[model samples]
Target: MTASFAAPRYIVDGGTEATSVLRRLARAGWTTREGFALPENTWDVSGTRLVLFGRVADADTAELAVLAAARGAGVVAIADAGSDVGRALYADLARVGPVSVDPDAPVAGESDEPASSGPQLAPEQRALLERLAGGETIAAAAAAEFLSLRTANRRIAEAREVLGVRTTREAVLAYLRIRRETREG
Candidate 1:
């Protein structure tokens, strides 16, 4: 039987940057809807083909994006591309599958540390560490890397020990520092 697909719905925010991005999506043929407030449940989303576009400015909006993506909708936040909220949303979505980002999007922050006066990571550990540095939670990073949460946590703990750190955040920062140093050297 031929599969039936629902028409995709676009959710846009009221902010200027978000609005500009919405206009771009509209010009590209997406029918847009205003996301005035986040829905309380996934059923409130209304459309099977949902695309949440704009900046997720608050926790509720981020929750809405997560709900939408959990229900198999495509969610794109174009405005807050480099902020913590953006990264959190991206990490949440990345847990389910690959999501798209604007090509010119800025990373949340930049680092300027010098390179590997530090211990090295194995390839798998490095992969997980990089994901964590990119704003992913330990569980989410593990999911992205196709590892069990337990395994990911173990690897993270091991990495922290190797890097002489005591927390996941420290491990991520340390890894990013090394990466920057390697890149700049």
Candidate 2:
């Protein structure tokens, strides 16, 4: 996947403030990184990266100006009107190391190809469906085998196809019919 530029950082001091900022950013079509702001504290960190800081106090703005120059480092700090840590964070980031911004990559997960070509059910899958019909929740069945909910749903869907049914209720009835026939035989 192609890389998109870094999103701006926002560290508000409260939920209402954060929501307001996010709303404004959304209206402007600016994307955001995930982070939360608490009362008296604001954090705009994302995925192990600290982006920026802001404050309501600060007589001088030179410290902030210098940090802005290092914007390309993918990190920045601004001390609020009278905050000491803001200056310390800027100083620490300035000398501690270099920050290189890399493009975001796509997440790799299980491919969505059909598990198999046709409507065949393994013995394990059949038993799972039976248990589900016997009052077991899908979550329980899935957890018992460590399979994902989607995988379990897929297995049940495959069973429905094999039994020529359109719904799980029909699938259960069909399965029961087949079982009764086999027992009599």
Candidate 3:
């Protein structure tokens, strides 16, 4: 006999780093979707989870935390270790007892090459490489996607691995080559 588990669902917001992290997590066995707005009063929270990669300006974090607690869903928030808001939210949610905070943790992993002779990229990975080609620093490219510096670096490293290159510059060249071939195909 075999046992099966349902994929954990996630409602997330932030920038590219957040989406990239979420995609990796999903590939590792979680179900995810982008949810920028607060859940409606009638929205069901029975079987889903929420992750806030950065501060949200429009939603009340405290209330959302409480609601998630009441519904027995877990909530995770990522924030800068030095930010007052991050500390306050962590303390407050600690009191609520169902929230976890990871301050300044790095998120991202290396991309691996496919077994075939040629390299391919997911759309997001291609976009990141494109940004790099356009002269954006890794940090800047990540910021444009709302990803943390660490996460961005990880994605770049992964890109290098996927392209079978050893350096960031090589990764960029490989990406360009792939893009050109794709276009000319």
Q: What is the C-alpha RMSD of each candidate to the true structure, in Å?
A: 12.0, 20.5, 13.0
**C-alpha local distance difference test of each model:** 0.59, 0.44, 0.52
List ranges where model 2 is wrong by over 4 Å: 1-120
- TM-score of each predicted structure versus truth: 0.40, 0.34, 0.39
Best by lDDT: 1
Between candidates 1 and 3, the one scoring higher on lDDT is 1
Q: Model 1 over residues 80-114: C-alpha lDDT tens digits?
A: 64667766665566554434443322111113332
Q: Write the per-residue lDDT of candidate 2 for residues 1-185, one digit (tens) a residue.
A: 01133333332334455445444444444433342222233232222222332342342443443343233212222234135644444333323222211111111121343333333344445666777778788788877755678776776777787777898777777776666666776
lDDT by residue for model 3 (1-185), tens: 01132122122234554555565654544444333244666444434543333343333754564455344333444344345555455444433332322212222222443233475454346667899999998888988866678766776777788788899999999988877876776
Off by over 4 Å in 1: 1-30, 36-48, 103-185
Clashing pairs in 3: 15-145, 15-146, 16-145, 16-146, 17-147, 110-158, 111-158
lDDT of 2 at 148: 72
* lDDT of the structure predicted as candidate 2: 0.44
